[model samples]
Target: MTPPMRLRRRVRFVFELARAVWWLTRIELGLRRNDLPALCAKLGIECDLRSAAPPATEYVVLPRRTRTTVLACAYAVARWPMGSTCLRRCLVLGRLLRSLEPVLRIGVRRDGELSVHSWLEIGGRTLDATSANYATLGSP
Candidate 1:
């Protein structure tokens, strides 16, 4: 018999949480120290790491369930004791949406305080919870 919707959602939540934890652990242990390209290679994901070009204006609509799963994964990963960085968040999100060819982006802002941030974009449109102020670095 089919499970109830609430039970299905809960199961999805748990799966997403486990997926997030696995990716976060792999990234932290295997890929965190490498440069952008190397990290992408190790993860078998593509991204933009350059700082040229304006943000893409096109947006793609992901299924509600997929979006929900990605959000849950992000939340779970970020809640870790040390907390997650933008790179970790984006990587986990990208892994979930790998078929979508999400472009992982690292941007920098150097106003008074220089800072770098990583985010994911799909079909040229930036994903939710991404910063708009940071300048685009590159993609793959």
Candidate 2:
């Protein structure tokens, strides 16, 4: 790649990362202050509060390259100070990759104590490693 092109890509990546972090912050704050449905509404995600399956709404389909870039940014921001939980990560990723039809899943397990986990999936494939230990409760 040309020097200018490389620089442009880097700039775009940084911008995407910043945007992801901003959204993550917003989601974290919303989770802390409001209910799930309210947060989803605020983020412009149409969700069915009564269903465990992924949202069944059409979204603006993003290009595969753009979706990949956004996913990279989302993962990068997952290490931020607030310590991204799976739920937060899924929420941010789901928002960023809505066009790809990401599903946000929550599961629970008991290994002496109750543990809950969340993850994102697309096309029946999980974006993150999920423990076989947890029993799926449902998706949001």
Candidate 3:
């Protein structure tokens, strides 16, 4: 790519990262003080906490470049002193990829002790690791 083009792309990426961080902060605060539905509403995502299946409405898949940027931002935030949890990451990702109709899933597993995990799914495919092992509790 040309030098100017590369610079422009980098600038856009940084902007997106900042936006993702802002949304993450909002989501974290919302989770601490409000209920799930309220948080979803604030983020402009229609979530059905009772539903397990992905939304029936069709959605266009997010472009690979955008998906990579979103995931990178999530990872960056997760490395902070106040690290992001699985639920938080999924919530943020769901909000970021709302146009793609991401499904936020919570699941549990019995591995000597019970453990809960959360992940996001798009087009019926799980977006992160560890979800395959957990029995789904529900999706939002």
Per-model TM-score versus the true fold: 0.83, 0.70, 0.78
Q: Tell me the TM-score of model 1.
A: 0.83
Candidate 3 deviation (Cα RMSD): 4.2
lDDT of 1 by residue, 1-140 (tens): 66699788878888888888888777776564787677776676687766577665455578785966777877877696657777777777787778788888777788898998877778778775545777776532
* Candidate 2 structure quality by residue, lDDT tens digits, 45-137: 544333454422233344657754666656665687888577777677678777677656567777899998766556656665543445566
Find the candidate with the highest lDDT and give its number. 1
True lDDT of residue 40, candidate 1: 74
Per-model CA lDDT versus the true structure: 0.74, 0.66, 0.71
Candidate 2, position 94, lDDT? 77
What is candidate 1's CA lDDT for residue 126? 77
Off by over 4 Å in 3: 46-48, 52-62, 138-140
Model 1, clash count? 11
lDDT of 2 at 58: 31
Greater-lDDT candidate between 1 and 2: 1
Candidate maximizing TM-score: 1
Q: Which residue pairs come into collision in candidate 2?
A: none
